[model samples]
Target: MTFKNAFMITLTAGSILASHLTQAGSPVHITVKNLSDQEMYYQSTSAMTQAHASPTPELLIKGKGSDEFRVTNPALPDVTTASLRYTIGNKTCEFRTSYIRTIAPGGLFSGKLNTAPKWDKKAISSGNATCTVTVTSTNFSDHSWSVVFTMK
Candidate 1:
C-alpha cells in the first residue's frame, strides 16, 4: 500500500479503538487542583448505576497544588451522580451534579474554587469533561454555602 493509504488505515483503526474504549466503560482519571492561595479541604462522593461507593474521608489540598483520583469503581461505572465538598479557611462550599450520563474512557475532570470574599455560591459544568465552582460571599449567620454545578 502507498504510505498515505497506510496512514489513513491506521488512523481509522485508532478512531474505532477509541470509540470502543469509551463504550466499554474504562476507568477515568480525575484531578482536582487547588488554584487558590489558601489551604483547602475536600471530600468526594460518587454514585453509579448498580452500586454506590462511600464518600471519601476529608482530605487536604494546599494552594497551587493538585491531587489525583481514579473513578474506576465498577458499581458506579456510569457515575451518574457526584458531589464535592471543600473547605477554605473558615468557610466551606460544596459542588454537586446529577445526571452526568456519560464520562468517556480516559476522561479527565477538573475543578477549581476561586478565592472567597465572605460567602460565594456557584457551579459550572463543561462539555469538555470539566467542572468549576466559585464562591464570593456567604451568610454570616451560619457561615455555610452551597454551590451546585449544573450539567451541560
Candidate 2:
C-alpha cells in the first residue's frame, strides 16, 4: 500500500477507537431551582464510598435562581433516583426521589426538584437534615447521593 493510504487507514482506525471511549457516556448534571420566595442553602454529595469521596460544599441559591452539580463517568451506571433533604422555614424534611431524567450514553439529562418539605412534628430537631438517593447507570456502577437544601 502507498504511504499516504497506509497513514490514512491508521488514522481512521485510531479515530474510531477514540470516539468510542469518549462517547461512551455523557456527564451527569443535576439542577436544583428555588421556586419559593425564600432563599435556600444546598449541598450535593456522593452517597457511595469511593477511593476519594466527592466533596460537597454548602451553597445558597436565591429565589428563582438555580444551581447545578455534575458527576461524570461513562463507565459508571446510570443514576435513576436521588435522595433529597431540605428545610423550609423551621421544618426539616427528608425523602428519597426517583425524579431523575433518563440519560442515555453520550446524551444529557436534566431533572428539576421542586418538592417542598412536609411538616412533621414528631422527630426531635437535630438542626441537620439528610437523605440517601440511589443511582445506577448503564454500566452497572452503583452510587448513592445526598443532595440537601435548606431554607435561608
Candidate 3:
C-alpha cells in the first residue's frame, strides 16, 4: 500500500480503539437518598490497601432529597474497602464493608447490615438507635467496581 493509504488506515484504527476505550471507562453513578424528614449528612471513604489512594468528599442531602455523584475507575488494585457515615438529627450511623473480586463484568453482590452501630452516649444523645444499612457491589472488575450504601 502507498504511504498515504497506510497512514490513513492506521489513524482510523486508532480512533476506533480510543472510542471503545472511552465508552468502556464510563463512570459509576452513585445516588444517595434521604427518605426521612430530617436533613442528612454523609461522607464516604474508599480505598484500596495500596499506596496513593484518592479521597472522597463529604456531602449533604436535604430533607427528603437525593444527591448523585459519579465515581470514575473505582475499586482499583483488586480489592477495596469503603466506609459510609450517615448523620440524621442527633444520630449518626456508619456502615463499612470490603468489596470482593468477581469474574463477571456485571456481577453484583448485596448484603444487609441490620445491626445497630455502636454509639457514644455523650457525643450523640440518642445512643440507642437502629439504621438499616444495605451494601451493594456492582459491575465487579479490577477497576470498575461500584459500591452503593443505602441507609434507612
RMSD per model, one decimal:
16.9, 12.9, 11.8
Query: Taking the tens digit of each residue's C-alpha lDDT, what string does model 3 give over 1-152?
Result: 99999999999999987765554232334445676777788744344211222334336777778665544433233334444567886677665444333344332444432321211111111334345433344443333434344444
Best prediction by lDDT: 3
Q: Rank all candidate structures by their TM-score, best first, as comma-separated numbers.
A: 3, 1, 2
User: Model 1, 18-120: lDDT tens per residue?
Assistant: 7655542223333455656767776443434113322332377777666554323333323333456566655555554332232234324445332222322
List ranges where model 2 is wrong by over 4 Å. 1-26, 43-46, 49-58, 73-75, 78-81, 91-152
What candidate 1 gets wrong by more than 4 Å, as runs, is: 1-26, 44-58, 76-80, 97-152
Judged by whole-model lDDT over C-alpha atoms, candidate 2 comes out at 0.41
Worst lDDT 10-window in candidate 3: 116-125
**Which is the leading candidate under TM-score?**
3
| Cα lDDT over the full model 1 | 0.44
Candidate with better lDDT, 1 vs 3: 3
Question: Candidate 1, clashing residue pairs?
Answer: 119-136, 119-137, 119-138, 120-135, 120-136, 120-137
